[model samples]
Target: MMTKHELRREYLDRRRALTDIEVQESSLQIANKVLELDIWSFSNYHVFLPIQKQKEINTQYLLHILQGKDKNIVVSKSNFEDISMSHYLLTDQTKLRINSHGIPEPDQNGIPIDEKNIDVVFVPLVIADRFGNRVGYGKGFYDRFLKKCRPDVIKIGLSMFEPLESKIDMHVNDVGLNYILYGEEVIDLG
Candidate 1:
């Protein structure tokens, strides 16, 4: 099995190799797939803004769709000092600033959204396996934040490519996803 570090490097290069047009189109496809889900059933949603440098799935498209539906679009603010992440409602007036890692995060300390209120979480990943195990940049930010979420909250990973057939090197601290929105398909691990 490939290690998480190896998978991260391998998939990050593949993502970076895609043309801008391909990225946008693939992102749209994945976004459209999730739109057909029972998304409206969830009132509060947690989502991530894209990191342009990595060419991640443009979840901005997903966010807009969720926004128009009047779902509570929640983004995050990462604090390296505490090795923790805080969730906030993304609004038109909320300022988004790119961090040192290039991930767009909400700037102002807006009202913190409670974990219990979040019914769904849209995760960004470097790659994932069919079993819903995934690799990000090796930062445990999402993993730590997710552990605190309600046990029944749906955690969905959005990826530009299909999942590898093999399982990932999952750690005890890692949080498994319930579904992966991969390359225009919604894969349910359960």
Candidate 2:
């Protein structure tokens, strides 16, 4: 099995190889597949916006769906120093700006929302296994964030590619996912 570092590189390279149109189409397909999930009943939903430079799955399509459903959307601002993220309630009045790391996030003026209120999280990952273990940028951002949430919270990983067939070596602090949403596919680990 490949190490998380290697998996990150491989998946990131695959993402970088995607053309702009391919990215758009795949992201839309994944977003459409999300509708098939039974998770819409949840109220407060946390989502990660794409880091364009990293070729992450564009979450705009998913955001539109959340808006249509009138879900209380929550976004995060990262603190690199501690590899932690601060949650904020995303609203029409919330101002967003790209951080130095290329992540689009809300400004400090955004109203804070605690992790306990989140019922679902649309996780960002490079790849995941059918067992729901995911590999991200190795920063432990999502792992730490998910750990702060209620144990029953649904964690869904969004990817442009399908999950890896091999099991990933999970760290002690790693948080597993409940579902993985890829292009026109969903792996329900629950």
What C-alpha lDDT do the candidate models reach, one value each? 0.88, 0.92
Q: Where does candidate 2 stray beyond 4 Å?
A: none
Please write out the lDDT profile of model 1 over residues 128-186, one tens digit for every residue.
Answer: 88898989888799999888899998999998889989999899999999999876589
Which regions of candidate 1 deviate over 4 angstroms?
Answer: none
Top TM-score prediction, candidate number? 2
Q: Give the number of the best model, judged by lDDT.
A: 2
Give a tens-digit lDDT track for model 2, residues 1-190: 7899999999899989999899899899999999999988889999999999888888999999999999999999999999999999999999999999999989999999999999999999998888899989988999999999999999999988888888999999999999999886798999
lDDT of 2: 0.92
* Residue pairs in candidate 1 whose N, alpha carbon or C atoms collide under 3 angstroms: none
Tell me each candidate's TM-score.
0.96, 0.98
Candidate 2 Cα deviation (angstroms), residue 188: 0.6
